[model samples]
Target: MISKYPQLFEFIEALLPDNFSQSQVGMSGATTNPRLVAQAVLESPHQWSDYLTSLSGRLTEAERARRLYDQVIVEGARQLHPLWISSRRTLGWLSAQIEGGEDMDERALVARGLQLARLAPNVMIKVPGSEQGYRAIEQLVAKGCSINNTFCFSVSQAAACLKAIHDGRLRAQLQGVSTERARYVISFMIGRLGAQEEFARQASQRRLCLTAADRRWAEILVYQAIQALLRRRPTPARLLLCSLKIDTDVQGREHCWHLQRTGADCTLYTLTPQIIEFLIRSQQQGRPVVPANGWVQVPKRVLNRLMAIPYFNQAYFEGDLAPADFASQPAFITASNDAREGTQRLSAFVQQTGDGAARPVIPPASDAPMEHWS
Candidate 1:
């Protein structure tokens, strides 16, 4: 498949394990979120039993959850550190996401990001793509921290983050701080974008004839437009495509639409283990046809029908949304809420664990040279 569909290899595989050895399978990087962490905690409670027991009982459930989240990311990064060093920091990055919720302010995000950065050099902190998130991203990057702008759905969000990253890199350079190892990425939740119902509602109101094909191409057009926009200027941040979903054609052949359509693009794709399995199993049928150009040309009729919808219009155009409009998008809101729920569930689960094994208390994270903010 690597020889046939080389584009599939250009991914920063998601869902990291404590002992990550999938690098041999063409995984260059990994990412995790509250949902992924919660899944991990549930899947391998025994692997973390001793570590969880070491956490102080005095800590709140929320605090314990955060600690567990960070520990998992740190362990993954540590395991990948050898590969990172061997590759001279070109690969083997693990993205550790901070707490996600509407209530996460800039100050708290920056503080959490700083803590995560100090845990591992190869860790890239994942920040939300809201207005405050962009501010935190800029501040953290200026302090020599790697960043991954996540929960992003529109071109405007990606553009804002690119500017933030560029400005932050400039500030870091001026401060004589080295960001050579600090890679940056902007994630496009393509699957979530497609799943949003706002487009259909808007089309209904406008009396536009929307079809399944139009719905499918909505995010693909947006992603291609963002890719073109990003390439128009040089910036340190790379565009990452995530939240990929699979679909079956009329002939009943399974396909990951985004990968089949634009997997050849020179951008990072973050695939979960399930998606990876789908790709591996898909090989049994034979090599799927992938387009030579990652930038897909939307059909004229499909574009005409989709342009009638306000959500589609906003998503397809770069300037339709301001930085302030990012959080209100249905896709962002749903994803953020899901993350919050995941975190809450994880905290409750941690509190309910019956493991009574007492172990040596894990010492608190050592303080790095603290940056005094006036």
Candidate 2:
């Protein structure tokens, strides 16, 4: 029986699945944190047993957890190495976050970022989009290290990251080093905005009614605005669409289709396995999957309405939305709380099972201006 449906897997692979090959398309990469690692360990304990055994007598509780994290990142990088090479150093980069507590210092972040970048050729260090994070990103990029600026929720954050990348590339150029190999990605989290809109609706009993569709529109606008900005002054940095919330509804599917249509160059989507599965199921069920021909035009009225929201304005306008601004917004506050709690839980688990190997010491920053760490 010839299936009338499009080959769902192929369609998604063309859209850049996290770990799949599609020569015509730039293969997207994966980003991992403690939560993802913990889930993986639970799903396949036997698979990770060897990793644990290797650390059993050699490391402390925290040190063991850190080693396990690095192992996972290195393995992932190996898997994506071909994509990295095939893209001529453009794609196929895996991101590993600095595992220190949230209050980790800037100097420590720079040291840690340098250490992570050395783990594998395709590894890009994931740094938080905080003030200290931006500073660290500037230092690393100036030295020719690729970076994934994570936890970005605003245009201000994204713009700041791009500026850092530009400045760093210039520094590398001046030092007689080719920056063709440096890659920078600014991750904009989408689903969290929808969640925030939904919560506001419920809290006001629909009086402050903003549907998920509205939030999705807002996200697209933000992305379009950022792309437009990038076009004016091209940089090595690319925008990564991430933290997508899976919505199986008609509107949700339409939003996804629209994004696929944008055909924005240098952009990548990092989707979770569950979301990929959802897309496959949706396509198999014969749901219409229309490809967008061009960027969706958000109506002026809608843009005005979105801009009326202080958070939306700050995010879109890149005005005064400092890293600390996250605490003042409910959506960001919730995300921060969730991350802190998750890290604490993961820490407790590590403490219980980890052997006491000494923590890995990050070497001090090198004196060379643009020397690649590796």
Candidate 3:
């Protein structure tokens, strides 16, 4: 809207709280260049016959051109924060880049990324846990590079990342250098498979079939992976949950709350704005929004089930995707048709847990009022 009607920005600015955001927008003028680059890439695949025709020159020249194009993308992502911060964009960009890679060539990509690192400290290089990307991650981090580990679903991916961090930390130690924050963030994409009804139904049935394999998912695997990494050599690496399928199991007479009520720790959860709005509205309506008793536990039954699945091998996931790409699975569409709608009250929770096998008890609806969980 601001791009179409510049005057509207003035009004919008006035309405916004006096913040640093407004100041930045004023300082750096906005343009549609990034969109054009995106369009160019999209068009290049099948739409731009002329460009393809024009580029069919010597092999040496073509390689240089490809490197230049990849640099543009890396730098563009570097400059634009939050705009392309979503896993979808980051994942898509990384996917497309790799799909276009020839003969497993990562030499040029690494060089370009290294150049961009010198450009800005806030910019983060995004890579996957693949052998190629892993190598790039280590080299970059060694040179004080920050990176996001995209497309990680299994523990092996986490293990590889942990090694990369340890290796970087070792290199830094040798060089007498230090990093302030986590040089790498392992992205644990959830909801991809759990989102779809058919898949969920099939998977639920499948879960019963392969419950053992399912136990090795994000929370448990990541928790264990973190411990494994910390044991070798500690490096700041956080597990970020993304593409959550259950924006909220804010359903049935019983709202399914999976997150533990434990105080904030290393774990991170990412939700769409839609979910945030829904949560806000729910609180307004006096729904009981309670956090879980503890972080979701990977049950022994689930661990056993995971072992049954033919393709659920933990080692296979350490490399590129086998048959299923975990990053793309948020199988089901979100449940809440209207994030804001006539809704039932939230599931009840007890202020205290009961003794022995007794479950925790929720306070009476009348006893408590509205408030943020944490």
Candidate 4:
């Protein structure tokens, strides 16, 4: 059947696995985390078991899990490799994160980043948006490695990511490296903001009544501001919108409509398989949704109200918000908690795979020297 919403399929085609050749959407990249990996294993045990069995006799439990994780990610990169080639190295990459560590130092982050980047040419090292992550982003970018700065909950964090990318590009230029092949993405977790808002409302016993769409708009405005800041850069990195939750048809329609209205360049929307299916169904049943000819305009009143809030200002304007500040934010706190739990689950999975394995092997530290950008 022909797609009613070709643009939506175009976007999906850009991000899906290589075998999905229905459309030629130019998705810049896709990302996978520990939770996502675990989910895939659970949902497709037969497919994953063969891969897991191959590594059973050769590695420790943790090592086996890590390798499987990398294997899956590399496969994804392979699927998206065509886009990378077609974009002239500007897009079509997959991201793999450094597992098991919550607070890695800059050096450690870089070491892990380099290790993950080595898995595939199209694999982007996914880093958390901690201060150390920012430093690692700069270092990796300088070395001409693609980086995806993940867990960015606030606008300040997003700005920090952009600054790091800019600095790294400059350093790459100095080191005689061609940055035309380098790409970076700052991801904003969309659905989590509404969850956070709800959490905050319940804990404080204050009813700051706002719909999920309202909360999402506030988050989008922050992204829009970041996009404005990036316009100043000679070669700006892409913005990725992730963690979209579609609970109802209306919500799904709204999400699709908003994406259609957003006319930003090099922007990517990463959807779960369920959401992608939902969009496909929506398009088949509903009328065609066309891409907006212009950028979606945020109401000045809404923007002003969001800017006036202290937390919002601190997050979007200061670019120096502390980790503690993020702890108080519902969305960030929830994500952190979820990540820890996900790690524990992976560890359990590793343990279940018995002790009949080879000796533990530690991945080598990256010896790449840090280049300074003046």
Candidate 5:
């Protein structure tokens, strides 16, 4: 099956939320460039059909499948933001169907995504976070489209998403497309979210810490995005949370807490069916959603401090996390993750300051170093 559609499969694989995902994998190839994207769209009719045929040897056109999806309620709601990516696992048949023509897979998929955009204000057309996808995402945004900047692994991808939103909007406005409806998001997968497992592990070896602060880098982008949206506010482009893989020991609340603190009307979470079900399961299991005062507030100052926490630091949660867990990941084994043992190396940094755990408690100050403002 993999060999049958190597390019398509790889393209889709990059889209799927994974245990370990990288931005490089997300933005690779036709997924990034515009010309490449147009080519994929033109060819999707046939390739999409081929992909579907591979699945059952008798699937209908992509349009039919999408129409069937219309009433399904698929994975909405939890997916606060809509994604517009072409996936091998899910949307792989796009290429073949597009190539097939009159069969109407390409038009159907694009139209369907566009049509569905109306239903959800937070629609985010997820491309492979690549050139082709990025191009498409940019275009969609100009068409008053919303985007889910998929395939993000590193800060670079985030930066790229921001630029694409701007470029896509400019192109649309220059061409007079009334891109006022255009919007975009920078989706950074949360759990199992690190670029590599080695990153998580190396932080452990270095006694580097992990904190909501580490994840806060995204907040800065989000805040900046919020500001940009306010100034230009092209359909309110935003920063979103996607690919949320949970770490049982971490006990963090990615969105619930974030929404509370940031009150970020612009953000949303695109949780997969699996992730949605998992969160449901966790909630049913009697896990507390918010610990203090029954709710968590996400003030900008808090977010700012949280963002200051550098990446790959495991020391932040060394006390919270078992060393074995860190040792098991590739980053830990390779000892190559660039973990930042926060400026405040004191153990006191643990337990407080953006600890995302459901019921996180700050450690006694006497036990650790005082958290610094710088």
Candidate 6:
């Protein structure tokens, strides 16, 4: 099915090799985070027990944790090394995230991004889309590092990141640095945008009863608007749509609207395990998929009601939210908080279990595979 759409690239959002292999038959790459790293360790302790034990007792807990985090990320990169080489670095990118915070300093983000990029050639640093984050992204890209701009939900944020990527690429070119393999992606968190709490609260406050379908259009429209914006000014970056939801219509037919309503060339979809399996099942059931050129026309009535919610309005329009206001947005706040918690959990696991030569006992294997930390 994916072959029918040459422009649509699928990446599995996972780390461990088994899941990577199972879901990656047609996947171009994978993504990792502190949370996913920790989950990977917890699920398959044997994979990291030796490395954990090898960490010198002289190192502090935080130092050990950081090393362990990098180790996991590097391992993930190694897992996809074959694909990276096979694709000539055009595919098989593993997005590794730095410590996330809305107010994180640009210098620190850039430093961490450089450190992650040094781990592997295909490690795409996951930078935030905050005000400072834009600077960090530019500097990293200028240094010839591939970047995956995360936590982006609005048109303004996407535009800002796109410009930053372009400037960075231009700077790299001017400096005679090779950026032939340095790819840039701006992620639009579709599910997070639609499921943000503030959107629901605002809708209720306005006495508007929005159905699931109505809420789904919020991110879809924003994505389309961003697509239109990108088409006007082509750049070296592609849009990666993540955090997508699978919904059922009134007729009980299942659909992942992000794929159903998807358009544009050079668009990437980073699918969770559930979404990948759902697609496989849907394909087996012979469910019809919309073509890559398909467009969804959002009704004016639905659009008007959606615009009534300031959160939706801010996300749907390009100039509604400034870069300075990005950190204050509900979607940004939620994603940042979630990322912080994920990092904390991984850190806690390292601190609590890093004592002495006592090998942490691996838990009994479960039927289910690990899910994303978010």
Report lDDT (CA) for all predictions.
Answer: 0.74, 0.64, 0.42, 0.64, 0.37, 0.77
Q: Which of candidates 1 and 5 reaches a greater TM-score?
A: 1
| 208-271: candidate 4 lDDT, tens digit per residue | 4455555556766666666676676655677777776544454454345345655465566775
Taking every candidate in turn, the Cα RMSD to the unseen true structure, in Å, is: 7.7, 7.9, 17.2, 7.7, 19.7, 5.4
Preferred candidate (TM-score higher): 2 or 5:
2
**Candidate 1 local Cα displacement, residue 278, angstroms:** 2.4
Candidate 2 lDDT (Cα, whole model)?
Answer: 0.64
lDDT of 6: 0.77
- Which pairs clash inside model 6? none
Number of backbone-clashing residue pairs for each candidate, in the order shown: 0, 5, 25, 0, 68, 0
- TM-score of every prediction relative to native: 0.86, 0.80, 0.52, 0.78, 0.39, 0.87
Q: Lowest-scoring 10 consecutive residues by lDDT in candidate 6?
A: 365-374
lDDT of 2 at 35: 54
Top candidate (lDDT): 6
lDDT of 1 by residue, 1-374 (tens): 34544544433232222334434345677787776666666666677665777878888767777788888888778877876787788777888888763568889999988998888888889899998999998899899899989899888888889888888888999999988878888888888886877877888898876666676788888888888878887887787888877787799878776777775457777766556656656654566434346456678988888877889877788879877888999999989987786687567666665345322222223211110000
Model 6, residue 288: C-alpha shift (Å): 4.8
Off by over 4 Å in 2: 1-27, 56-58, 100-102, 197-207, 248-266, 285-291, 323-332, 354-374
| Model 5 CA deviation exceeding 4 Å by range | 1-124, 131-136, 139-145, 204-235, 245-265, 272-374
In model 1, what lDDT does residue 373 have? 6
lDDT of 6 by residue, 1-374 (tens): 34543332232223223444333345678776655666677676656666767888898877887888888888878877877787677767789988763557999999888989999887899998899999999889889999999989899998999889889888999999888888888888888888877888899999999788888888889999888888888887888888867887789989888877885555788777667657656655667454357677889999989989888889888899999998888888888887776677666667656643433334334212223311
Model 3 residue runs over 4 Å out of place are 1-104, 175-182, 193-233, 247-264, 287-293, 310-374
Question: Which numbered prediction scores highest in TM-score against the true structure?
Answer: 6
56-119 per-residue lDDT for model 2 (tens digits):
5856766766676677778878877887788776667788777652456679989988888899
